[model samples]
Target: MKNLLVTQYQDFVRWLTRRLGSSDLAQDALQETFLRLEQGSSIGPVHNPKAYLLRIALNMASNRRAADNRRLATSEVDKLLDLPDDAPDPARAVEAKSEISALKRALAELPARRREIFLASWIENLPHPEIARRYQISIRTVQIELKLALEYCDSRLNRRNKLRG
Candidate 1:
């Protein structure tokens, strides 16, 4: 299984990049696809491994886009984008930059496996069953890992905020 994943990984990524129109986003989808196999989800006798992988990647990528649209609707900036172009607020921009930096630091602090799991689950917006199958763990494990990851990063960000205030 691992051998199959290693051999065809790059090709799958390229296919995804073309489909999604972004190499960076494609790489993330690839990681999430690999994560599913890593967990042993049992797709049940895939005759064409590459095609199967592509299908999974394609599905994941589509799901991510849909999820992003859903999230965007609820986000703070969603209501503001329709407004006429105007000078951006310097304070808001600086705060956004600071928040991004803090997130990077918190991500770097995570254990390697935990970070991968977190990325595949949260950043990539993959389902728990998918993550569990890839990591060869339980859905509960994915949830637990995601919960811990969110908590750790939130704490870091909160601490940084406290310092700033």
Candidate 2:
């Protein structure tokens, strides 16, 4: 969404109008483009938001054209357009929330070193060797800590699940 802030929205829509050859289609494409961008907030930062948006928009347009082509050629492909995205049921949503809460509590309970190593390894995407080098520990030590952290979380979640049941 931050990357989208760099572009003047009206300008992108105008460009899309020229490219896609229909104002209505351009509007639809622009809305879909931003929806896609909103879905991926982890896109951090980009050097050129305009270029990124253009690429995504172009890809979206291309995909739509391809889908239309498929619909024209095959009856089965046309049915795909009518299918709706299924939302999770309330019970499933509640179960997922409880599981996530248990995981968060388990993560909080981890010892500082193991937690740090665990986060760096799993969340931050730092490699075991990189974490070892950064923390001035052997790679094997990083591996052990991460393993213990995962095991602790698993046991805690399993206990929580039994209680819930």
Candidate 3:
């Protein structure tokens, strides 16, 4: 195998350069093929050693191409590192907190039973039928209570936004 490889090394590089479009890569692939052959890989009798050697070199080129494809280039890595973070900054964080406080105040102003039903459905993620069963009320009554609570909260938030803007 080594004798055959040495004899056809130039032919393989030329063939690979045409296939891979890079003589440098063809040389590199041939180097790896030489190293792998030196590793004493078991081989039985082969009628066509040249073809077998070409197949191994081509496979090495394919594997190197695949590995290169999966890696990020240096420019790509630098660009990604330079991108601005998505986390909210200090001013936006404070504004979000203020809005949440306003929402809590609005929810606090609801009548006791309506508040409980609203919290159960919205915060606890309880379905309407479960809320009705828990509160011993009809589904219609639960729907009405939730609607009124939502309207009251929406109005309060809208008014707050108007004042702020």
Candidate 4:
């Protein structure tokens, strides 16, 4: 049974990594999933091991995507956008810079988990089941977090617009 599981595990991980778009992340999630399975964590059964592992892989990918988004969003602004020294229009450049700054500030204000859900869903194009699995939470929770985060971001941006007016 153990050897069977191990062999199945490799095939599952390969399918999952291909689906999720990152070999390193797929391997990490595969390791964790097998560890859980070995400990008898009960993620269901092996009849559909591919489907089961894919679900687990999705969750792991969502978590990593969230973390990477946060890191990118918080890093130095100048480093985020690489523009050539030649400025076609100085005024447009300044406005673009200001908009980027505003976006960064808004992203920073959001709670980490909320931010992660929003980015993973919207920017990374991850499905909700994968996100829920990654966070070990329910799909409902993922939906709620994303909705609230978007509302919060919208409100904040509206307020900024009013202040500018």
Candidate 5:
């Protein structure tokens, strides 16, 4: 049973890693998946071990990505806090800062779930079926979210560009 699980999961991890576009993250997610399996954690079943593992991996990756984004946002805020109140050319700096703020605001305005689907599909390059499975939704839903996200991003960018012009 152990050997079979190892072989099956290892192959699935390899495939998932490729799908996820990050070998290091894949390794981490794969290990977590197996740990959950070994502990008898109720994450579906072993009938389609590959699909189950992929789902686990996708969830883990999404979580890690969110944590990373939070850290980055925190750091950016800290940097802004450290800026000198009496800096030279404050107006120019303020304008530049406003642009960054606008972009961040635009991203934050997107629906959380749609943002996740967008990032996973475009940034992570995960396939629709795999993302759908990971989120326990249909592929059609993934397609719809991705479409909405793209439209949102496009419009936001266009507006920002117009403002700059």
Candidate 6:
């Protein structure tokens, strides 16, 4: 099984890419299929190895497509854009700006390390592992710093909100 996959990997990827319309998704499916084959239990005699591998890859692609479809439709964003504008009123806009300024101040008050970690994780959408690797700290430390930073900012914002109320 492994030998067949290795020999025909490119062909499989190309076939899947054409069917799936995404080379990246094709690569992912093939990689997953290979991993599964490695850990797969003993297989009985196969009549056609290439057919078997293609079936597995196709099944994986189908499953991935179904899972992705369940998450969100590609047209959802377009539908949102077609919606009527619901612009904020002057008072609401002013209030929102004030809240944003307060949040900025709260963020600025955080320790440099904590602030950087928070921004990297949320604003930059970085994975915790990458952030930890960059900071030369454990993932756990990254999580802790993020948690503390969030708590501090939330408290500051909540306090400000209460004052306005």
Alpha-carbon lDDT, every model: 0.80, 0.80, 0.89, 0.74, 0.75, 0.88
Q: What is the C-alpha RMSD of each candidate to the true structure, in Å?
A: 26.6, 19.7, 4.1, 24.4, 24.6, 18.8
The local distance difference test score of model 3 is: 0.89
| Whole-model lDDT, model 1 | 0.80
- Model 4 scores a C-alpha lDDT of 0.74
Off by over 4 Å in 2: 1-74, 81-86, 159-165
User: Candidate 3 or 5, higher lDDT?
Assistant: 3
Task: Give a tens-digit lDDT track for model 6, residues 22-125.
Answer: 99999888887898898978889999999998888888888988898887566897897899968998999999999899889999999999999999998999
Compared with the true structure, what per-residue lDDT tens digits does model 1 show for residues 89-149?
9998899899999899999999887888999975798888988888999988887887777
lDDT of 1 at 108: 95
Model 4, span 35-96: residue lDDT tens? 66678654544686556666766786787788887774544676656656675598988987
Alpha carbon lDDT of residue 41, candidate 1? 68
Q: After superposition, how far is residue 60 of candidate 4 from its true place, in Å?
A: 65
Model 3, residue 47: distance off in Å is: 5.7
* Cα-based TM-score, every candidate: 0.44, 0.49, 0.71, 0.38, 0.40, 0.45
Writing each residue's lDDT as its tens digit, candidate 5 over 46-100 gives 6865565678778878887788776757778899999887764978899879767
Least accurate 10 contiguous residues by lDDT in model 3:
156-165
Show model 4 residue runs off by greater than 4 Å: 1-93, 159-165
User: Which model is ahead, 2 or 4, in terms of TM-score?
Assistant: 2
Tell me which of candidates 3 and 6 scores higher on lDDT.
Answer: 3
The better-scoring model by TM-score among 5 and 6 is 6
Q: lDDT at 161 for candidate 1?
A: 30
Candidate 4 C-alpha error for residue 59, in Å: 65
Model 5 clashing residue pairs (backbone) = none
Worst 10 residues of 2 by lDDT: 156-165
Better of 5 and 6 by lDDT: 6
Candidate 3, 74-145: lDDT as tens digits: 999999999999999999999989988988999999999999999999899999999999999999999999
